[model samples]
Target: MSSWFEERRADKVADAEEQRRTRAFEAELRREERRKDRDEERADKAQARRDKALRKQARAARREKTLTPGNVYRKGTLLLVAMSALAAIPAQVAYFVKKSLMLLPVPFALEGAAWVMAAGVAYADERKLPAWVRWLLRAFCLSAAGFAARINYIHGSEQGALVGWGLAAVTMLGPLYFEVRQWVITLSAAISNPRQQAEERARRKHDRRRRRHHRDVAKVADRLVSAAPYGTLKPEEAWARAWAIVHGTTEPGMTPRMHAWAVKSAAALATAQQPLPLDSKTIRTRIEGRLHASAFVLPTASGTPLGMTKSAQVVTDLPPASKTREKTPVKPARRQPPAHRRSKGDALPFHPIAKTVAADTARKVTAVNGHH
Candidate 1:
């Protein structure tokens, strides 16, 4: 029984040890999880900081791009124009409303007309309308502004001279400023770089000179342009075609005759530059004469000249003379006169003078041949 009790005690001790180990393992696992969570939090914080920095940098870049000089000028001008309109419109409305409520729309109508005309000027420029149209819009805009100014002057005159002048000036200022701004914009658009201007001038001068020099070709080109479908043929292409038709050559600045002359001149130049060939017979004769003048010398064992042998004499001894035969002179054969060819009209009766003339000519030809 005591031994059995000891065994139960031993089992209890082992169970306690197992519980302790399980608790330690759970604590270690919790510690590991907390470490991982902390690391993840640090990484998230670092990412957030990087994103914030990037956002700030992007914002600065955008600000720098948006604050350019041209953008400032354009926005500032628009702001000033808006303020001017606000200031001017109220004065006109006050002046007109004092007269009658029924006349309330008059102020707006006058302001609208001036602004509409101003807008029309811009539209005209955009559409590339004629200068006259743009100028007409400018005139209308100014006229409306002047009429409004006069009304303001009349209304303010009841108060005082200074007030009247101030009101009139203010009333005119908006449209006048707008018109000046438009003029400035137009002139700025029209202005070109000095070099570009010079190039344009030179091009115009060249075009004028070309038209003057090729007046006939230019006329034909103009006719072609008129005859073709609208926008179908370019001026340059028409001019090229016209040049070809007039000069009978596709090459610019050259005619067929000029080409022929150039070819002939080139051929003449090539011929002049060529070296003349030496005559073979003349060279042979010169060589033979030189050989005949010099004698072939032979030396003995002591290097002294044994004797001189004439090459001409050696040449004569090299070949034997052949036999010759005499010939008898043969008599020359007599020439026969050519036969007369009958004309197609031989069957027809001829005039006496014509027959006699023909007969005389035949006899003369035969006599000449016989004498030869």
Candidate 2:
């Protein structure tokens, strides 16, 4: 019985040991699988890096092949692009050199060289240059002139300095003078442009109507004076009243000087014609009495006045004195602020001459009514 128990225990121990060894073998297999996966991942990464480098090199080679001068006709645009970049190299070099120089901060030496290079870029038969290059050259040339002016001001007498600076300026900017000479030609062409001439002609055509209208207005004024009866006032005063009656308002748009001109023109024409036999003083006195009786309504020109009104009538056609008279209730005049209350720059309520004229007219009117 003891031997049977011992054999069972030994069998159990061997089975347990076998299970532990199987677990260790599986763990080893899993570790080997993980290592293989890591190696594959690393190899793939290395291959991808090599492929990327190869692609970059190939692209660079293709770019270089396209830029070769022999293939210029085949890659015309590409060649131009390459040349444009090459053209820029000089300016960039100059700028760096200018920056490196501690003696001059203004960079005039590089600027002059750049200006000359600009002309080469402009007129060179090498069709590789772009339109933008012309503008870049122009900017460089403009700055070069300022440097030349500065050199002239500071060291014009130094032939050595002049030669060095001036040579750079000549190389860069000398050709720009040719472009400047075109200004006179361009201006002349603009002045003589067919389109501009046509516009000027159209403008002149419109002026004719304005001139005719002015002439017609002057004629109307002269006719008014000729029709008017003689009065106590001067010919100029009588004409002014007649003009107001004919036009209804003062001459439209006429300056004071222009109004004076129209009056003189009308008076000249009227004096040349026949005069009426009416007594001037008696006519004036009657006109004054009638004026006091009612408010006067100046007549407007009959038939198409300034093309604004279709039908009009003369002042004589106004309603009779008794019929036109109004018994309107008087409203109080606007009360003006007293002189002491007025602001510093305020105008007076009445002008001195106007006050005197009102007083004289009132006295005359009172005397006339008494006589009547």
Candidate 3:
């Protein structure tokens, strides 16, 4: 009985030890398999990276080969694209550089450049630009001009833009007109047949009618001048009546000089009793009488409320108001207050004539220095 119990205990101990050993071996095998998986993954990633690098190198080499001068003909489209980009690059750089130097907005300057470039391309290739391009560029230019012109006209300021645009139109359109005349002659030659001649004559007639319609605008100047009450007024008063007449209905995007002309025409006719807007002859006569007693509206072009300066408009940062106390710009020693007594009870020490002379002198000096 003792031997049988001993044998059974030994057998149980051996079985338990075997089971522990088996479990340890299985865990070790799993660890080895996991390590192999990590190594394989690392190897695969390195291989992929090498392959990608090689592919990139191959692509770069291919591009370089195709872009060589000898290969240019085979890559005509690419050549044009590159040329276009190259053409645009200088303008792009110039625009941004100008903006950085406080010249113009980058976007606006670039857009202007794009427009010029487009025009150049069309002219060089001898292709008429798409209508949309012209329309878009015109829209951009007009929008900028309209806002600036409106504000400048209303404020009766902007020495440059007003003058610049007017002068520019004169200079540019002068040559353009002659060229157009030549072009017209060429075009007319192509249509010398009787039927075509008739069409041309009708077109000319239509153009004439349109121009006449615009030209026959009321001579406001005559009305204001002859309106007796306003017409006979002092310069200040006359100017007011003239201004009122101009403002009443003359904002048809014409020059202020044109506005003055219209006012003068209207005034000349007014004494003969033309009906004014919303006012009876009696009311008009009364206002004119009052105006005549005071200063005549001196028909100064820039003196008009909505007058555009016919000069080159320069970009300047004007203060909101120049009413604050400031130091003397030249002397730098005098502290100028609001009530600066340059003249008796005149408020400020600002002399427009003096400033203008100084500015002109300075400009001339600078120009002379540049020549030197």
Which of the numbered candidates is closest to the native, going by highest TM-score? Answer: 1
For residues 1-372, write the lDDT of model 2, one tens digit per residue. Answer: 999999999999999999999999999999999999999999999999999999999999998897676355435533443453344334334444555756353444544454465555546324545768756766666566455444433342345765445444443343344334333333444577788788988877755664466555545545655676654345445445555665555654555677789999999999888665445454556555754554323323454222111221212223334655458976875995453543454322333443555565666566656743
Q: Say which candidate scores most in lDDT.
A: 1
Collision count for each candidate, in order: 0, 3, 62
* Best-first order by TM-score: 1, 2, 3
Per-residue lDDT tens digits of candidate 3, residues 137-192? Answer: 54554444344333223223235556445433332332233233334444555566
Tens-digit per-residue lDDT, 1-372, candidate 1: 999999999999999999999999999999999999999999999999999999999999988777877566656766776776676677778877887878898988988898899989988987889999999999999898889888888887889988788878877777776776777777667774778877999999988999999898899999999999999999999999999999988787898889999999999999999976545444446455754565545444356643434331121112334486448765675784464455564322433443555565556556545742
Candidate 1, which segments miss by more than 4 Å at Cα? 1-21, 97-102, 127-131, 154-166, 179-213, 231-236, 256-261, 264-268, 275-372
**C-alpha RMSD by candidate, in order:** 23.2, 32.8, 42.6
Q: Candidate 3, TM-score vs. the true structure? A: 0.21
Give the candidates in order of lDDT, highest first.
1, 2, 3
Model 3's alpha-carbon lDDT is: 0.50
Clashes of 2: 3
TM-score of each: 0.57, 0.22, 0.21
- Over 4 Å off, model 2: 2-10, 44-48, 51-157, 160-372
